[model samples]
Target: MENRAVLAAVLMAALLILYQVFFIPATAPPPPARAPEGVSKPVPPQEKTAPPPPAVLPAAKVLPRLPERTVSVDTPLYHAIVGSEGGRLLGWTLHYRGEKVLAERGQMGLSGLILERSGVGGQPVEFSITGGPVVLDGKAGEGTLVMTGEDAYGVRVRETATFRADQYAVDLSVRLENGRRVRQTLTVALPWIAPVKPGTDGAQWPSELVWQVDGTVHREPFDKATVAEETPGDWAGLDSLYYLTALIPKRPPTSPGLSLAVGKVGEDRVEVGLRGAVTLAAGEVWEARAQLYAGPKEYRQLRAHGLEGAINFGGFPLPRKYGGLPMEWLGVPVLLVMNFFYRFIGNYGVAIILLTVVTKVLFYPLTVKSMTSMKKMQTIQPQANALRAKHKSDPQRAQRETLELYRREGVNPLGGCLPMVIQVPIFYALYIALSVSVELQNAGFICFGRAPGWFPFVGGTDLWICDLAAPDPLYVLPILMGVTMFVQQKMQPTMGDPNQAKMMLIMPFVFTFMFLKLPSGLVLYWTVSNALQILQQRLMNRKPARVAGRGAKDVARV
Candidate 1:
């Protein structure tokens, strides 16, 4: 039986290796070829054509230009014409009330503002803003605005001239018939920080500016001398054009830096802010508009907005298909539960623990049955050993006797294995969930520190350490997991020869080492599960030594 287990494990491992090395790559489609320039085919000649003389006509009288009318309103509720050019959000104009934005042929930078594009073709993107008497500065005003399209690369502008002021932030509030009102406040509080050139003195400053997004009020001094390489993309693999740095001050200031980060909350949607600590004025609702990107990371957003790649955190080499699907599928449920737990427990670590407990409880029955079957196998080890020894030379006969013994004892040899096999999919699903879970990105877990740096391949500023998007280090966890696994195996009844038991010990180490570099959350799951299993085994059975002695005595009598 031990030999059989070793063979099964070896077969499974071979299959996995083959699947990863050959099958998966084979299934991926080849990349498209690039088109060559200046390649044109000759056109066919027309069959026939008629030549005609040209005639000149007198110029018609010029028509007078029509006067453009404008509308004004007292209420804040109004539609805005929004648009983007070359993937950059330009601006928006209040359709009925505000002044029109000049159709400029230059790039417009709405720095520090989150913007997302909508509408098709040259069609205007429209959104309603309610809740204002139109406050521009210290006064109230109103005007008509029209935002037009431009025909140039990287040139976008939304014309609105209600009362432009350099000092005051623009506030637009909108009310819906459903009684939900939204207020969008636009503030140009800070200058657009330029991207620190690589190998320059300023580059180090951006890298040294440590920002925390765990709803904590901590600050680190801005180091103009620190430099760090910029990651290429956002969380969704979109291009990152800017490198964001926290404006931490040495001394406590009256005001602190403000920014938002986006992460996936669930299956269908990404949560924009998980731990943003922004305050809203009384009667002033806060709203954020950002381009929700779902693609590969590049420097596009940073180049366009100068806001840096606030979304990208590195880890894991999850094949996009396998990685993205599981994350997207289980993101919502996991986040929802996590959020609920955090709200009540006030600790993200506790939330994860609770989440794990809940999950295990949900799968308790299967695990219980698996344990029971393992116990039965242990109980019948003596008979199994006897059968194996009786037909040692005849391997097929040995297997047949073993099967008959299992049937007679009402034991399923594969029963214990089946539940574990069933759990693979579930474990994989959770693995995907935790890997892409934005909630867990900067989240903390005791002294282990932030999720990123807590374990290998999880956290840290280094690309290798931060590569949450790749496979793990495969050294620590896998070995520990294998050790625990071997111990669990040792606690189980043995039916095979010395070779089989030796293989069992080796198998645990192999699996444990395989998991070392995986996400800490996945490791946490396995570790916790293993501990529980050990406890469960101890509680379920009496002295294994005594059982083994009884089995040996029975074998001797036979």
Candidate 2:
């Protein structure tokens, strides 16, 4: 008996040590490296030298041929045609397909492609296209497409359809004839260029994407790989999560100039502006064409526009970070299905509820078997307790006898936990899906309040109670959840000491607090699931009781 007690103690100790060592805290893989801080131009590799300088076009050779028919030009920027069949442009070339800005220069500080300026009120002079004097069916029709700056701060150029057939491929161009010799410095802000590394002082990694001039190369620094706060304000509110600058080469003789600036307007938007400067002779025209992309991180649209690697779906902290990929992968299918269902249902909240129901139905068999096993064990608890009392001084013997009792009753001690273990991954997957799905970011639910903010709060207060996303501050949902769990436990046959029932009672509140901050969508699922489990248990309990004596001896075989 003494030897058996020692052996049991050693085995239990070993199991506990193994559990602590292997399962206590899960670790994730290392993340990718972040960009370095401060500006240091990247040196071209000796093996791959920079290409020879571009050929400059002279004024006479580059001038467009004038058409016989005269048309009135009324826009602030003069629109002119270059070739008989080429497109027309105001002072600049009309880049209908959009031109990538290699680099820009102006009265601003440049970091990569971000240009920063203070006190400048006028719009940054950039490229713009002149709408068509398009000819349709060989008949001249008049319509103007004007691309201009919203304010003195920036320019927005959009494609416009012209009725002129000859204008299909117009050669658009811009000419900047400045009166003063502007002292402008150019900076490259292309993603293809090496990223600005994070500073050693642990300053926030500059939240910007890199752009390339020569080729379609872009790189978005992974949020997990860097320590940077997503600046909040109008820009963030606008949901313009990421930004990039294009780098284009200079047109001619005047030095290629690039400018990038970063500025903040109070607590509103963090504006990033890029400008290209050309020093013009009194009558000389310094022209450059550039393309700008300003929108949400729509990966497909961005890639279609030849802007690759510019979409940054911010990654969360560590072990959680590793989970992003799997979560996104799972989300794709779930979102698709949910979207389809929502189209038919017209209610996101109802869709979620229906989705939960479908999931429960699919998992019902496993749950049913688990619950049935628990019931059987509950029925046999009296016998298990008798065995425990019989060998009170010898735990090993008691445990072995309990096992024998379980076997005779055809009960598996781990049966109930097995199904629960399987459900954990799915639950976590749902958690991740709800957190990052942009569709759900600002989605609304039934009166529970706006879906939830990035994090939960009560009426914008920090106090934990009003956080509906988290636990019910009133303890209503959690209390109900706990009650259901307690009933589930009661309905199940007991396997260990009756004292453990108190521990089971504590689990619902523990889980409730843990889930309070979670999205209401998740909470709804759990609440429904708990209710269903209770209903299922009640139904299961209604079945006739098993004849005990006949199965008692048979339990040892299992």
Candidate 3:
């Protein structure tokens, strides 16, 4: 945000949607927050700043061009091709996910380091490859690919990428030696540079620039206007919905720099990197090491590396510290439970079902108590209304009698709502866990096939529920979920306004349409939850309610 006023406005807007009584209102969904905060140079509202300019471009080189070579490093975890030109990562394919991370043609492919003078417009140091085609044997367990080069500035550069057979992470270390007689300070940037047009926006597979500073992580929209923090932090990188590529510093740099940014590198090109400077006296070598994580956002896997923050579990949209609600605390536990269930069940779809069942059971006592209180209130409402009518001439007495009736009936007005209130955090966390857990990707539950040309826009093969992470192609789970929710709502005792009851009934359809495109795993969870609620309500109705006779007895007295 440009200033406190803007920040406050954003916070208020976020609060309008978050923490609402009903997640999906009878009204339309609230609009989105304008943007997430970026920790970078704060600019004046009237003054516009370009994304930090690309690292300085070197002056036209009169020297001959050094040949660029691509070296292949095949590990058990990943197959990668590295370009020698700038030590850029050319191609990376995760063995487990079987997804090839695409890289734009011109920009550094996310593993290259660029050296420039200590500010914008600083001349970038160019490297000429003077090394071999890096070699590594995955069967040997571990190895390193070293690409050595030297810049025109009296500096020698060594970029070594360490690979292990069993890990998704690759550690990169850059060793720089000042070959000059005098001391020199140069800005160092490791960029995940890509070609993105200005004002580009997307959500299906969003790419955000993330960085941590002073122990807090901030994710910024890849705005056309660059956002880069000058103060260096633990790490910076770019990530998409299911995949992550982050740079975590193994240790703080010995030499500090003038600026650090996760921003743009050039026109039509974007970058997210930790920028710093190293001042080295002649003949002195400075080295910096960072761990690069490039893999699926498996909660347990990333957590093991302390990089689990890369997963975007939707949080409370807010003007709060760290820019939003930190749902990870609760969400992580839910995710862990779901994964644990997966280990036992071997199918993520069933795992999600088990998770939902466990959650319902865990909160069963709270749910029963809430329902009981609502039933009690429903039972006594008519008598309370009669008392109010009797004392209508004296409004104070009417309220007073209503309170006494409530007390005698042993009904706590807030009981029905308070337990639900206590459960809200867990509910929100479960939603987030279902949404962001990557294990559900392509994890199947069931599949139904359609004959060729059976319906318009319908294909031949079995598509329904084939991928739990994707929407149900036939809209089965969402409709079932909605139906279950409506039935559950209808079965519950309504104690308040009739119009509110009707609105509550209408919520099912609204959510049905909303869930049409949501991941099937989430829809499955909702459906199961609603079904459980319905079953509980039916069982409660079957057994004579403890307060069922109270209403009739009180009405007779009246």
Measured by TM-score, the strongest candidate is: 3
lDDT of 2 by residue, 1-558 (tens): 999999999999999989967987733223223212112122233343455333232221122333422222322211223111111121122222122122122111122112223332222223233543432343343354443211121212222222232222122223233232222222222111212333343111244444443443223333312322222111111112322333222232233333332334233223343344332222222333333333223344345455543433323333433553334444445555666677898666566677777777878898888877777776677667677777899999999988977786678989878997887666666655544343433344544433334554444333322222343443455556566666666666654655687777677767866765565555666776777778877877787447455445533533
Judging by TM-score, tell me the better candidate of 1 and 2: 2
Cand. 3 Cα-lDDT = 0.71
- Which sections of candidate 2 miss by over 4 Å? 1-125, 128-325, 392-397, 445-492, 513-517, 544-558
For candidate 1, the per-residue lDDT at 528 reads 67
Q: Could you estimate the TM-score for every candidate?
A: 0.43, 0.48, 0.80
**How far off is residue 490 in model 3, in Å?**
2.0
Give the runs in model 3 whose Cα sits over 4 Å from its true position.
1-63, 102-104, 117-140, 180-185, 197-206, 224-229, 252-259, 317-324, 448-457, 460-462, 494-496
In order, the Cα lDDT scores of the candidates are: 0.40, 0.43, 0.71
Query: How far is 454's C-alpha from truth in model 3 (Å)?
Result: 7.1
1-558 per-residue lDDT for model 1 (tens digits):
999999999999999878876866522123223212111111233235343223222122343333322222222322222222211123322221123221111221222222221221122222222222233332344443333322211112232323232211222211111111221112212111222222322111122222333322112222332332221122111112122322211111222322333222223222121112222221222222222221111223223432222323322345343343323234346656766888888666567667778778787888877877877777777777788888899999999988976786578889888988877655665665565454444344543323566646555533222222233333444556667787888876664568977887787767775776666556665666776778777876753432445565556754
Error of 2 at 350 (Å): 0.6
Q: Candidate 2's error at 404, in angstroms?
A: 3.6
